[model samples]
Target: MRIPRIYSAGDLAENTSAELDAAASNHVGKVLRMKPGQSLILFNGSGVDYTATITCVTKKHVIASIESATEIPSESPLATHIGQVMSRGDRMDYMIQKSTELGATEITPLTSERCEVKLKGDREEKRVKQWQQIAISAAEQCGRSKVPLIHPITSVDDWVDNKPEDSLGLVLHHRTTQQLTGIDKPQRVCLLIGPEGGLSEAEIESAINKQFIATTFGPRVFRTETAPVAALSVLQWLWGDFNR
Candidate 1:
């Protein structure tokens, strides 16, 4: 059987015991019903995987003995940060999960003029936490040692203004005929995907003014949630780990 990989928030060191966090503990003890001596993999988003053996299991806690640490170089060479306008319902959840699996270094929930989702105060905090968990789960399943950072929701204008200076920025829109073929390879990339109703002409122009190249995958337009998956896949194949 395949050994389960669990994400633990605490520090993990070789030959040391690690107390799995409450969520991980519940997964191992209550959900999986794993017993002592069962082997598992633990990661703390440190780019290292800890080989561990279950040592204790209680109703609310699961402790594991770290056997060894192995560096897992699963990150893509081309760092991709996705700024996605929040979609309604499970669409946003699906985007976060797929973006994590696709080697997104960071994801920011963007609020665009056409965005249908409105989250504020406690609801916003709760949603960010939930989206982060989704990224963690995707990392666990996809053998990624590092979980992508999920930023709190921000407006499109604010997100564009705050992009890393060194990163190449690309905004996806159907109106643009620009493609990724002629663009020079970049060490880091920031991709902005608009909402279901799409970004306004002024919003797209604003991003373009901020040095964001308006680009498209093809003549066809993808849904807000699906664009990240397609764009990231092509990016990985062209400039990331896919060729390696």
Candidate 2:
């Protein structure tokens, strides 16, 4: 059987025994029905994988003993950050999950002129935590050693303005003739995508003034959730591990 992989929040060390947090414990004891003596791999976004064997499983707790730890070099050399405008329903969840699987290093949910989702206070906090867990699950399934960072919701202009100087920024729109293939490979890329109705003309212009190049896939316009997957995949193929 394929040993299930899980994400642990606390630090793990070789030959150490630790009690898993409630979420992990619940998953191990209730959801997965994992029993004592079964082996599982654990990662904490620390770039290390710990081979662990369950020592105890109970209604409220699960304990594991770390057998060994190994470094995982699964990260892509090309760092890609996506600034995605917020969407409704499960679209944001879908976008975050697929983006993590596609090797996006960081994700910043944006509030745009056309944004449909509004989050604030406790609701926003809860939503971000939910999105973060989705990223963790994606990392586990994809064999990624490190989980992608999910940032708090911010405005499109704020996100674009705060990008690192060396990051090559690209804003997706329908009018642009520029394509991903036309650009030279950079060490990092910060892609800006709009919401359901798409970014406003002024929003696109602000991104351009901030040195973000306008990019278009074709005449077709992709949904907020679907565009990131296609764009990131193409970018990975061109500049990341797909080339290897």
Best by TM-score: 1
* Model 1 RMSD, rounded to 1 decimal: 0.7
Q: Please write out the lDDT profile of model 2 over residues 1-244, one tens digit for every residue.
A: 8998889898789999978888888988999999999999988899999999999999999999999999988898999999999899999999999999899999999998889888999999999999999999899999999999999999998999998999999899888788876578899999999999999999999999999999987899898899999999988898999789
Q: Candidate 2 clashing pairs?
A: none
Regions more than 4 Å wrong, model 2: none
* Every model's TM-score: 0.99, 0.97
Tell me, by lDDT, which candidate is best: 1
In lDDT terms, how accurate is model 2? Answer: 0.92
Give candidate 1's error at residue 172 in angstroms.
0.2
